[model samples]
Target: MEDGDLLSRALDFYGLPKKFDANLVRSRFRELSRKYHPDSGEYETDILFKELVQLRDVLLSSLQNDPFAILENSKEDPEGFQFYKSAKQKAAQAIEKYFQFTDGNPVYLKKEDNPALLRLRQELETAKNGLEEFLEKFPKSIWKEDTETTLKKISVWFKD
Candidate 1:
């Protein structure tokens, strides 16, 4: 089976959003695992348990390489901390657009080098530039590390 297919199936099985963090995946898996575990005397124990493990592994692995996963817990805005938030949000939206096209599985998009992918890359670059602008404007901002980390994460996609 294709990785995307597996990922989609995993997402469906876990009842998770396309954009999820490792903690969410793990927590959900554990919740389901408790119910489906063979030791719990659930029906179709072996197959269901195995499938859950596989899907959990797939999601966890995919998230590790997922550039946009950085955005999952990045809404840490305090009062008057909107500096460059729009730029970060722009990059996030660009990522979401790509994921939307690919049904949340980047593997599908990575296989094709069409105009859509090119545009996505361009959009990502623009977002990166925005983040750079933020950094330039606020060199001593409290969010400097986060801004830099976000820039580096977005750059990861271009490397591929």
Candidate 2:
């Protein structure tokens, strides 16, 4: 099936409305999972449960990159969306790297200077710069507010 079809099927399978939030999707998935889970004894087989897992992953991944995206008739700006998604991934990875090295406590980042942390910081700076550029390039993008909000949060950690 096509990507769009997969998303639509997932929504239908979970009995979710076209316009729904991540929490709603997750909640519905959990409830259904309990019913279809192989170990739940509610279903004799795992086939339906496995399918549910895949559908849940597809929906969650879609939400992660594009929260505003819906199976609507209007088309989205693919180029801008791809760029924003890439930049968002970079920023998220940088944050994860920093946290991994810092043991989730950012206070140590200010006191210590290590090669790994320095590299992670540079990567984050690049992601931050990319996001700023995205705002300029896609001035009318639907993701503008989200990109700006992400930049603001990143700034909080890098303020000098």
Q: What is the lDDT of residue 1 in candidate 2?
A: 86
For residues 2-24, could you state the per-residue lDDT of candidate 2 as single tens digits?
Answer: 98899899989999877665677
Model 1 lDDT at residue 86 = 56
lDDT of 1 by residue, 1-160 (tens): 9999999999999999887767789899889988788887466557898899999999987854453434423555332145466567778888898778868543424526544677778888867876776677568888888989999888777754
Which stretches of candidate 1 lie above 4 Å from their native place? 69-160
Q: Give all candidates' CA lDDT scores.
A: 0.74, 0.75
Q: Report backbone clashes per prediction.
A: 0, 0
- Model 2 lowest lDDT segment of ten: 67-76
- Top lDDT: which candidate number? 2
Global lDDT for candidate 2?
0.75
Candidate 1 least-lDDT 10 residues: 72-81
